[model samples]
Target: MEIVLKKGTFLVFLCVAILASAQISVKRLNDPAIVAQHKRMTFESWGDWRPYPKYFLGIQTNFAYATVWGMWAPKINRDYKDGDDIRPLKSTGEQNLRFAQLKFQEEEVKKIKAASDTIYKRSVQDLAHWTSATVDADPLWLLYYKRMLKPITEFPDNPQNFMEWRLKDQQTFETLNSTGTLKRLQEELDLIKEKYTWSRTMDMPRGKRFIMFHETLIRWRIFVQELRRYNNRTTLLLDYRSILNSHLPTALPTQWTPTSDKGIVQNVMQQYKHKY
Candidate 1:
């Protein structure tokens, strides 16, 4: 019985010792200091921390300064260091000149914008008037009538040429009666006026402005010339009819010389060119 009890006691002590050793090993492995040391070793193997010494020094310096000042340091004049003094602030001559130049440019832009608005308003009014007038008394229609009265010899001789001429003539006649030159001119004028309404003069190129102005002038000239021609032909017809009626002492036949005098139409047709 004594020998069995001694063997059992020795086995129990050996089991307790093994358990304590395992617990000690686990605690040491999980210790914060040991883990930190391992991480340090891994980082050191990669590179020295000397390259970032300036950054660390700057952080430390800032911390030290903050601790010393504690929000009581001068904040407003902090930009000025010792021995610094304030002097009168005056702009240089060049700066003043530049400022004046900028002011002049701004004023000039204002003047140009005002002028452009005025011109655009006037142009739109003129275009609207012309558009309305053309609707009732289309100069192109009168011109076409005069043209059709001309002899066929005055037109193109070649078949292709004649076809092209007829096509263009038909197109012109249709367009004049439909969305005619006056309507197109009004549309163009309105488009430019709208474009420049919100935009500055400098935004619109000078060349574009000049080209539009030139085109408007040319169309205006053509309209005035055709209107004059129509007026002259109508006046001449009325005068001829009046003279014939006075000499006859009796009212002429309705078919003798209609309001659209065929003789006057034929005579005026010779003076007009085929081109619009």
Candidate 2:
């Protein structure tokens, strides 16, 4: 196929070709600097050339791929036995994010029984090394409770970190309290739902941390996108007080006035004073 290039394109192409060939020649060449130079050429051409949307998408995709890549590696390499099959250490469930606390809870009964048995056997088998009989009565149950408390105490997070990644969510939520209708609040919720579904569930420490980071970033992106969209819409409001009040009712100062193009919507709540 015929191709076209802008001026200096031939030189650029030649440099890229050399870099591409460098990987294969690295062993024969026996010099790390040569490979580094080749890499420099390739990345130099692509310097700061990232398409952000695609870059982030690539990050998310790479994260997802790396998370699940183990499912596709060569089977068992059984002859050498380096321990590839993690399904055994794992429970017989869809291998997903390990909410370790929930997992500990699920196995809590077994754990509790085991703990109790250990205590009982210890007391029966040896007095000085054993815990008290009362403590031994159901030691596992106590252990399970101790383990379960950490994650459970974090439930329904009281709106502190709920919008941690979502600046727009917080903004919109605050906005709704002032000039927004309930519908607007619902819309903000929808914005959050659109992009931030957590898909990868593997619970490896490092990999899952990356997954969580990107997942949090996805929520932030959704928030910022919606915020910009909201900013672009006219007729939303220009009364700084109104806009701010919508999102931060409790933060209101007593003497603030609403001053939009339409002037002000009088406080009908005070004037209309419906009987309870």
How high is each candidate's TM-score? Answer: 0.23, 0.18
> Residue 140 in model 1: shift from native, Å?
31
C-alpha lDDT of all candidate models, in order? 0.46, 0.43
Candidate 2 residue lDDT tens string, 1-276: 235555468879888999889866876586543454344343232122111122364354343323322223345322212433333223432233355656877799888999999999876655422323332233542564324332222322233321532334444444433554435534554544332222122222333433443554555456456645554332254345566568843434534433343443454233335633
Give the CA lDDT, 0 to 100, for residue 58 in model 2.
Answer: 38
Clash pairs, model 1 backbone: none
Model 2, TM vs. native: 0.18
What would the per-residue lDDT of candidate 1 be over residues 42-144, giving only the tens digit for each residue?
3222122121122364354344334333233366423432223222122333445577889999999999999999999988766643442332243542554
Off by over 4 Å in 2: 1-205, 231-276
Error of 2 at 18 (Å): 95
- For all candidates, the clash counts are 0, 10
What C-alpha lDDT does candidate 2 achieve relative to the native structure? Answer: 0.43
- Which consecutive 10 residues in model 2 have the weakest lDDT in total? 45-54
